[model samples]
Target: MNKEALIALGLTLEQADKVIEGYGTTIPKSRFDEVNTSKKQLETDLASRDKQLEELKKVDAAGLQTKITELQQENAEAKTNYENDLKASQLSSAIKLALVGKVHDSDIATSLIDTALIELDTEGKVTKGLDEQLKTLQESKPFLFVPEKKEQKFKGWDPAGSNLDKDLPQDIGFNFAKEANSKGAPAEKALNPWGQ
Candidate 1:
């Protein structure tokens, strides 16, 4: 309170000042042994906690770390094997599509396909040179060569020639007719691959 408020409450400013200064006092423990017992208990609890932490720090962690490393290595190995198997399956698919199984020996096809370099950077992509490799194999073993179809050349329209004097293809009511003996028949499949 201010000096005027203290005077209105019938107390001198000096007396009020003393009351405010004596807000709290020290504890008066009548028994000395009781205080000594509490202090000892607190000290013992602190010492036990410290000892527990020290014992925990003394454990052997190196063995556990070694086991973890071994497990990681094993996981990596299994992943590599799985990836290799998947690649083999993909190579086998390409070989089947190329008909190596039907025309050439499976042993040679398997060897070539196995060595084929598949996608190195991306997963699930076929080899870069797989088509060319199969082509090479086809050349070596001509039995599997599929000859490209040759386009037939049609004679242009002429008054005195094969076609009449008129436009073709785009002409309305235009009908094309094939001539006999224009193309030869395909050769029969040879039983022996080396003969062809």
Candidate 2:
């Protein structure tokens, strides 16, 4: 309280001054010190923010916008290039899968196919002339493709125990002369292979 306000409460001039001097001493000094410290910190932060704002005002707005636009364009171009590369990679994988077990040389077959005519769908499938181009390449260059294997047939004689007993007579005699003749030998030579 001020000295005049304390005097208005019926204290004398000396008593009012003493009361004013002892008024705030009852409360801790550290509390006011803390509040003053916080106030100073707030002022310092406000001044720092004001200085930063002044620095920001000095920046070139038009130049910053142009740079931002250029960066955005570069980012868009990079994204487009990445998408194109991804589509091309997917198309190459599709082509390789389609050529598996069909082409003699996969690299040569891939080179022969018209990749420009091919397009990848959203599902990453060949959506255009890839199949037709591969077919045309196969027809134009037959040597590049592995020939379709012909189904093989077994033509050799059957096993001895299989159906032979039913076909032949039970008393079919063993004729040495016929056997030897069939083997391109005389009967005597066939019987004595040692030439004894």
Candidate 3:
């Protein structure tokens, strides 16, 4: 029976006992304390996890900064090495041109000669010296260092026209045709049996 019902009915111990005995049921105790304890433990665990995450973030940031410094050092060294190699190659080309009588200005060639002399020294500043030599060359012979032009080859199918068969050595044309045929190429129109 409910507490209000018991109060309203002015139930005696004997009457309550009779009702409960008939129902064969018992009242359960509250679990408020167990629930409160579990809540507190969960909050504590969350706070500890947040603190650990912050420490990990700091460690990661430090590692990233170290990596950046290392990469910057490597890049600087690589640039220095590349500049030195480029100066050496330019000096070599200049010397080759001078020896081949391709130089126009004696003074500019002399500057290259001096730079080459400096490069041969034990503590030579080849990079700086080469720059000075190039500047001198540019001022003295503005157009003498023009790039060499390449000759274009003839690409027509019949370089000698109707006399192509006769002009080309028999062995050369036959070998070329054989190679082309082996690679599944069609025979030249003039050489084909159908004359296509």
Candidate 4:
């Protein structure tokens, strides 16, 4: 199980190494890789911003001031874009987690969800209309969800609940000591494998 193969499957270096160490066990697609890639891109953007700042320092005072304003605006736009992307990613992940075990077709179910109305709480839980929307969808489009399983109630005797003293006849069970004494054998011989 090569790390490269695992990495190609959208795993990080650490994740790929762990998989290799674990003998190449199957792993589902990871959101961590997406987040990690985004983080690296953000770092690269910051590095470029730093380089631009250094270049701006070498320019005339008027040009440097204009450049500073432009860079600030660009930074603001980048921040907004990053925030929006992060929120969208969070919303998608939250929806997927919520839909698990409930939906038959996750892609269809997720598409049915009105993502615009969904928001995440501070604790990362889906809040402010997601649950209500899911409930509404579950009612209107029942086919998208897995069928609710009905539990069968057993009418037979439950061994775990039954008491042997009450259920079994007193004479039906054997007593080794009584049987051996009746046969004229000693109690010691009946009870112990090695008689003293």
Over the full model, what C-alpha lDDT does candidate 1 score relative to the true structure? 0.60
Clashing residue pairs in candidate 1 (N, C-alpha, C atoms within 3 angstroms)? none
Top lDDT prediction, candidate number: 4
**What TM-score quantifies how close candidate 4 is to the native fold?**
0.49
Among all windows of 10 consecutive residues in model 2, the one with the lowest summed lDDT is 169-178
Tell me the tens digit of each residue's lDDT in model 4 across 24-95.
Answer: 654445766887889999999999999999997887999778999999999999999999999888888888
Q: Write the per-residue lDDT of candidate 2 for residues 1-196, one digit (tens) a residue.
A: 4777777989999998788777743445788799999999999999999999999999999999999999999999999999989877888888887778988888788877778888777776777787787777777888888889999988878664354556652222234333555586565546432223
Number of the top TM-score candidate: 2
| lDDT (Cα, tens digit) per residue for candidate 3, span 1-196 | 4544654688886777677678744443446677778999999999999999998877877778999999999999999999989887666554554435444554455544565444533333233355466566667765755445689898878643345566544454555675666565554433432222
| lDDT of all predictions | 0.60, 0.77, 0.61, 0.78
What's the TM for model 1?
A: 0.35
RMSD per model, one decimal: 17.8, 13.3, 16.6, 30.1
Candidate 1: segments with Cα more than 4 A from true spot: 1-60, 100-108, 118-127, 144-196
Candidate 2, position 178, lDDT: 37
Give lDDT: candidate 4, residue 143.
Answer: 88
Clashing pairs in 3: none
